[model samples]
Target chain A: SQQGEEDPQALSIQEGENATMNCSYKTSINNLQWYRQNSGRGLVHLILIRSNEREKHSGRLRVTLDTSKKSSSLLITASRAADTASYFCATERERGTSYGKLTFGQGTILTVHP
Target chain B: DVKVTQSSRYLVKRTGEKVFLECVQDMDHENMFWYRQDPGLGLRLIYFSYDVKMKEKGDIPEGYSVSREKKERFSLILESASTNQTSMYLCASSPHTGGKNIQYFGAGTRLSVL
Candidate 1:
């Protein structure tokens, strides 16, 4: 069973709008990281939020994590056509076992129409 | 700049043929992983290596094997390719930083088994 699962599998929004994607995991994790992938390309690291942290921001990206609910959300503001891509959330399990291993989510496909 | 490179962008192989997908990282990362991406299934980890000559089976490793003869290289092998094995294979490497081990991914190889 996959540990991380993203919601709103597909999203479409016009350029300059905002897009939000959510992810939920089944187990405890040390940290949650987000990544983006352009069409047919590799994934690019985005932002990471530690279990102790509730929210983080990088440029126009904002990530919020709720350990209580085992869920996280990513917000992309002022979206551009170039921002269209597949977004994935990966969780690194709590330490002690499975060190350096991450479980990835199914991902959300975001389309920023110009 | 961290870079993880996959040997091919696309590959085609016949059923029952031996197949190998190669990945190399320039960041001197200590951890390398192999995953296959399928639509709606997300990225499923097949194998990961924490050190040279060390390997661990991931969530889905039944049809694949891996080799990590060197710190900079990790190889995913399909002993006998099958149609069901076709997928977009992604290789990733992360430094053993002991904190926030963010993974850098390759562009991926789209393999088609006929």
Candidate 2:
């Protein structure tokens, strides 16, 4: 399992502040993804950055991938109270067979206070 | 809108009992996955199916089995439930478009074994 480790197991911030989380994995990957879970229910895919790509943005989310370091960072700018949730980083390795599987890191619990 | 739906929001089962969890997707995705999320442990894949009647074990597939009879439906079975099996189960689906694998997740099912 190419399980990754996430830095800062927990984070707290006020509304309108920016939040950033970082992830480090052990193996080479095809892509890395960030996901947000609200109340530990459904997970919504926030953004994805491929190995060849340096940075990618979706809405208020910015994801940067550094394959040379086997790490990635997710930045959420101008966060809202609704953005308070657990964030996870997942790695998609190059599959030899039929595989769209992802290995996730221990998530970072973020609290955005209003 | 693409959607993945799990059968139950919460479930309670006794130890040694057989348990089944069902998942369905509407996007006609080729890849479907079942994962268990534990506190501080992140999401661990139990099983995934890329096509009908084809299944692959994920990182932690112990005591868990899966079935993909149709394209849109996937089922997870625990032959014998245990106290340690109490956790949040998440189902996800991803389309096979070129080399891109963007996953869509379902509202998870919280299962508790007593």
Candidate 3:
């Protein structure tokens, strides 16, 4: 079973609008990372936020982690058509025997319109 | 920039055929992973390696196996490819540092079993 799940399986918005995707996980994690995948391509690492960190930012991407809620959100500010992709949240479990293995969510497909 | 390269962008094979999907990372990352992506199911990890000659099974490892004879190369093998194994296969690599496991991914191989 997948450890994480993302809400609003699909999201569409105008180019300048901000896109927000949420992810909820089942267990305690050492860290959570977000990745973006363009159509039919490999995923790209966007940002990573550790369990101890509440929020992080990189360029126009903002990520927030709430351990109490076992959830995380990725926000793309001032989105562009180039940002259209599937966004996935992956969790690195704190107690898993498999080191460096990540459990990924179902992912939210984001479509940015021009 | 980190570059994780896969052997093929697309592949088509028959059921009961042995198949190999190769991945190489130029960054010399310590950890490498293999995952399959499907519609509505997200990405499922198949196998991973932390070092040369070391391998670990991930969540969905039943139909797949991996080899890491060299530090920079990881190969996913399907002993007998089944129709159910048709999906997008991705390879990723990451460095072991700072409690961070941000993975860099390859463009993926879209495999079809006929």
Per-model TM values vs. the true structure:
0.98, 0.97, 0.97
Candidate 3 positional error at B111, Å: 0.6
> In angstroms, how far off is B19's CA in candidate 1?
0.7
DockQ, all models:
0.81, 0.75, 0.82
Candidate 2 has an lDDT of 0.90
Ranking by DockQ: 3, 1, 2
lDDT of 3 by residue, A32-67 (tens): 999999999999888989999999999999999999
- Native A-B contact fraction in model 1: 0.72
Highest TM-score: give the candidate number. 1
The top-ranked prediction according to lDDT is 1
Error of 1 at B41 (Å): 0.4
Candidate 3: clashing pairs of residues = none
Better of 2 and 3 by lDDT: 3
Which runs of model 2 end up more than 4 angstroms from their true locations?
Answer: none
True contacts kept of each: 0.72, 0.66, 0.78
Order the candidates by lDDT, highest first: 1, 3, 2
For residue B53, give model 1's deviation from the true position in Å. Answer: 0.2
- Report lDDT (CA) for all predictions: 0.94, 0.90, 0.93
lDDT of 1 by residue, B9-113 (tens): 999999999999999999889999999999999999999999999999998999899999999999999999999999999999998877588999999999999
Please give the TM-score of chain B in predicted model 1.
0.98
Cα displacement (angstroms), candidate 3, residue B76, comes to: 0.8
